[model samples]
Target: MLRRVDSWTRTLRHAKPSSSESVRLVVERLSHEGRGVVRPGGKVGFVAGALPGESIEARLVERHRRFDEYRLLDVVEASPRRVTPACPIVERCGGCDLQHLDHDAQLDHKTAVLRELMSRTAGLEPAVPEAPLRSPPFGYRRRARLAWHVPRRGAPRLGFRQAGSREIVALAACPVLDPVLASLPGRLQPVLASLRRPRQLGHVELTVSESGDGRPWPVLYLHLVEALAAEDRARVAGFAAAEGAYLYLGLADQRAECVYRPEPQAPGYLLPESGLRLTFEPGDFLQGNAAVNRAMVRRVVEWLSGDGVRRVVDAFCGLGNFALPLAAAGLAVEGYEGDAALVDRARRNAADLGLDDRARFSVRDLDADAGLPDGVDAVLLDPPRTGAAALAAALAARPVPVVAYVSCAPATLTRDAAVLAGAGYRLERLAAVDMFPQTAHIEAMALFTR
Candidate 1:
């Protein structure tokens, strides 16, 4: 679907491609990579996703040498409506990028981009596009990784990387995070300070649970290069109590050095709004935005309300995040996951939530034979970055009347969208959620119905 530009057009002075050609151009549109495109005379300069129609100064971030490449450098005339970002390290933290824009505006940009991608990238007609579903933009992320660095020249820091770089960004606090975990940095430094060489620490894992008081606790995974002293063990225990973080010293890996650390707790998070819960160990998959997740669940439920779906198959179901909630709502749900551990955990969660009767879990590699349950009314899939190509092919041949495809990446979704369109499933809805604010990541939900 790439539009082939004529070589003659390329020779035009305005359309000439060069790295040194610089001009302050208005951001006309956002590309799939979350960069803004500027029509400087004729050639296009891809800037980091700045708002469309907004005039901003940008510098070249990369150049093909033969082609124009640039990154947004400054927002001198930031949209008056642009609000100050909530995260103290918003300028440096690589985790999010759209926080400066109003939440609603971000949602709008994401929605339009998805639609445009479908039209431009997949050759789909704009008029034939689906209605998009919207989700809450904040406090929805249940999983995140924090980098570990000891304080020598400055305070020990734990936060995300800077945008477009691997360099760790020092942060005072992350506003989008659950309040419980946000206070961790202050308390964690003192605990790590006792280590012989504190700066050698590597990483931290944080996950929030919806149970009990809805606290965001660290399943503290410390990556240390050396063993902990006996005094360090006692210090770790005291720090866990004081910081409310469950400490696990890596004796072999990064956190095993502390002998006095308590038992390690697995990283798990719950989605109460959907009557569902997902359990994952450190570094596993979980949605970045929590509020948007609730909104996504609500949207699915709303669609189900009218679909008359009974037998449901959730392909690539992660810990029954969607299947369990749907089952709890009276739909018989058969959930599938690639990981056996996740399958077992999903079953346990269903039993604990009293939703076992309606929900069931199975472990199957989705890339292999998709042995589906017969007489299924719908198929819900939340695939990884690659999207669900095989599952889409299977569903195309099945009698599934409704299909909900949730994707974190749009390009792959569009590829699968083309395949689905060929298989008779019509693109019905595409909703964008600002899950990682101040960052380029976009979470989208697409519904296909035959």
Candidate 2:
């Protein structure tokens, strides 16, 4: 069923390429998803792999009511900022988007993208400071999820899919993955080779963390499409023992029950520069990059320390990432999360950090209509890509004095920013962080003060 549907989707025909069109349209701006937005015939069209001021021939893929999406046909002319891509597989693999351009230019483009989104989507124009980018653009990804597939008659391979397709691109080594976890596919290939044909390996999850004893160890979580046999379990255990990495497997079921072998020290770990350490289970949600995450927390704390601001409410807070840090800084912080288990973990983590008295964790679904406690000096919101519409509305109704929003999605962030701006809050500052270097995923921080 899956393969047939994938094949049909792959065969869907796209619109004609812009080769004979006499009108030349220039790219005016870039979309949040890294697509170029151009106005042709007073209509908007999104061009893939395009930069502002670049004129390129693109093939239209889909025509919507408001806009159209197009694919790069040929770069008739190139932009000055455009540079040769470093990785050979960049064009094919969807792993990284901004690798073709220089890192400095990438930062500039992101800043411009955010500025456009803020001004157009929201009425206010925010000033963005020159935020630092991560060094060594390649091989920085410490975690990855790869699809497992074996050709009908050939050997099995593991990697990500091509851009805008379901076809998996087999990879021997990934430059973005951690060196130790990157070698897992090659090391485990032999063990998988012994399995029967059409073995049920769906996806592979790799995470690196430190043990309770302060020893670093990599944990590989395998989600299977079928039940594991005795030999399969043995192979996993043997691989974990040999590779010095922990192994956790999720069986295929209605709920997909996860089973961990040989006791895992921790599913994930975070060691901040401020002497705050966190350990979470495998299924818990945590920030991908640790260094930048700590920096973001510290920056937020620094911004919150002002006159008459004695208390803070962290909405959508996960595992006390912001709450504990704020508490450590001697502020009365209250953290809320939707997950009950995560809320418990946050409390435990705060207690472990000797900050339980200063910090409090509560399980509150921000999506619903929940009442806020009195005397919330400020609100720190870190919501998912859906954005915190409900929370924003509630915050606006109460008219919070300050809001520091950390968002991964520019479109949704701008939407929420407009809502807050409507309620008399003005966007004061914006900063773009290249949390995901290679990909078009841009992490931004926006501050709105009443």
Q: How does candidate 2 fare on TM-score?
A: 0.85
lDDT of 1 by residue, 217-312 (tens): 655656555655667666766777665566655544332332232334344565676644555554446676666667677777766656578888
Reference-based TM-score of each model: 0.81, 0.85
Clashing residue pairs found in predicted model 2:
none
Off by over 4 Å in 2: 1-29, 36-46, 53-77, 127-136, 196-198, 211-215, 252-264
lDDT of 1 at 94: 63
lDDT of 2 by residue, 61-115 (tens): 6668999766655566677777766665666676876665677777777777787
Candidate number achieving the greatest TM-score relative to the actual structure? 2
